[model samples]
Target: MSPDIRDEAVEMWFGPQHVSAHGWAAKLTVVGDFIVECDPHAGYFHRSAEKVLEFRTFKQGPLVLERMCMLEAFLAEYPYISAVEQIAGVEVPERAKVLRTIMMEASRIHSLQFWWGQFSAELGLFAMTLWPWVDREFFLDTFEELTGSRHAVSFSTPGGVRYDFNEKVLKKLDRALQRLEQHLPKFKDMLLRSPTFRMRTKGIALFSYEDALRWGLSGPNIKACGVPMDLRKDWPDLNLAYDLVDWEVPVVDNPDHPGQSDAYDRMVQRFLEVETSINIIRQLLPQIPEGPIVDPKARAKTNRLPAGEAYGRVEGTRGVTTVWLKTTEKAQTPYRAKIRGPCFASYYSLKHLVPGSTFADFIVVFGSLDPYPGWWDR
Candidate 1:
């Protein structure tokens, strides 16, 4: 290598910090204030969750799976549980389906608010961070009241859920979500609607729609690119949730360029998903049936299926999360498990996006994508 080129760039490390929220450890090659290249390290966060799933009984697996991400624990657990149920040929009760839908929506609200808070916090908007948590508490309260625990409830099971959604609790949840809707405008004004925030984010970190697709982005990331791709919308009637809920997949293409997606659009997409969750919660509560929450014979102790394999997927707050389960005849434990973590694609694509941007812009881009580093290199 030429001495001049070596002098042109210097290397630096972003993190491998003991308590990083995103658990990232990246090495960057920079020229002055601009990043020339970035090589992100991943092993620091590998949990090997798929391998761990093989060691636990079907009912016990979710207990560990929920540990993959703190903010979206329940959402991470859903795909795997759905996989197990499918391979076992388990039929969920109508009431249980309703309960699952409600819980999934509620949990999604928690995750959206979480990322909202993190996004605000990243920009030094501490007050906005606190504001979203207040709304998120409404959903967490509902979880605690219904499932008897807050995070990692493990309430979802192969046949159905571990508990029923009581009418009174549903009423309480409805009231809480309605209250959350009332406070949305204040946050919009503070963050998304703020002129300063727009100036910083609107024209910055713009990626082409094709680039978004090539990088395998999902959730708000891809939606912001105008792809309108959603597992719920693409896969018909996986259950009744997506089909019956009647929700639109929010798409946010670049305003200036008309065909691109930007950091601001990603934030806008997230904000819209928050509103959609409220709508979903309201729609499902009244529709919840009065029936058994679980099928008696579908309990894990009695699960003895013929050897087979099945895959299940669901749209999570971050994106589409998929799980594959293979079973041995009459075995209560899975012979193998494979997980498709939502944040992994974005994690790998960071190198392509980070170069040629200022160090200041780095925070904006990373904060916008918001990949949970725990999901990477695993």
Candidate 2:
């Protein structure tokens, strides 16, 4: 509206249709070809999950939380369930612990595949997206066979998991792990060898070691920045057999790149992480001790936790998802429940990152980070 504004600096809308946009569009003010500012508008799929949870029984809250991040539903549910169990002082059965770990790993790969493949697609490399999706579907197929749902699995409950795993699910899991292992190299080669991907992403985002820590980035985003901090390893309440698995966290802060944490590095970091995750799954499956998937006596309903406050944090696909719960001694519902989603932190960084970059590059960076907008808007 001002004479000082560049003629090309009109606001452009990246509508909800784009894959990376995650069904939420932005009103971006552009000057020439660079995005000067972005009004990120979400609520496209706002279900008001927290408000809805108040109405459901305590045992039914996991279903509400799982939808918070459909891609990483199990990971999202873990902290919430853990909070409930801790508040109620419920000791989960050993079999349920192993099943929870297995489900967590499966969800991690499932969500990473989406991030890795979408990164390629956002860069206009169709094959990178297609191959990984095809490969990822193999894993989803296992989830479906096991839980009877591919995504938005409400398999988890407050006391323990809602159902049990039979020999059939175990067999399916074994096959899925093998397929994922076989496909990992192909995914890596497809992303790593692409010159376009490398050129576009390399040395772009540039969040330094201190900056990453300052911003409180986590998961692959932090691990990619040469930090070995993983909540699963840092906090052992997860009851994971991480020590049994031989894998390394991929940390790459190339001096040559010189504080440049670009889209390429972010992508390559995921490539490395995916390989690590696959290797971990391989060792975990064969070593999976004979046990029930859930506590045989655990009730599917009417499992009320203690009356107290408890917090649970887990390394979700995007980052740390922390669930806080407050319970009343004689009540069957939580007095208060809150979620600190990692994507919410990443979304704030966008205000700093989006400007000065082309709209397309903004999309590239956004996709590479793979923030689950649903987690934030919910």
In order of appearance, the predictions have TM-scores of 0.94, 0.91
Using TM-score as the measure, which candidate wins?
A: 1
Residue 277 of model 2 has an lDDT of 72
lDDT string for model 1 (1-378, tens) is 357866989998888762333467778888899898888777877777878888888878877777776567667777777877777677778887878888887888888888888877777778988988887887788888888877867878878888777776677687778877898877877887787788778767788878878888788888887878888788753443656687887787665776677788888888788888888777877787788888878765336656888888888888878888888888778899888888888877778888888877777787788788766644
Query: After superposing candidate 1, which stretches have Cα over 4 Å from the reference?
Result: 1-3, 18-22, 237-240, 300-302
Model 1 gets an lDDT of: 0.78
Off by over 4 Å in 2: 1-8, 17-20, 238-247, 258-260, 296-302
CA-lDDT, candidates in order: 0.78, 0.74
Task: Give model 2's TM-score versus the native structure.
Answer: 0.91
- How much is 177 displaced in model 1, in angstroms? 0.6
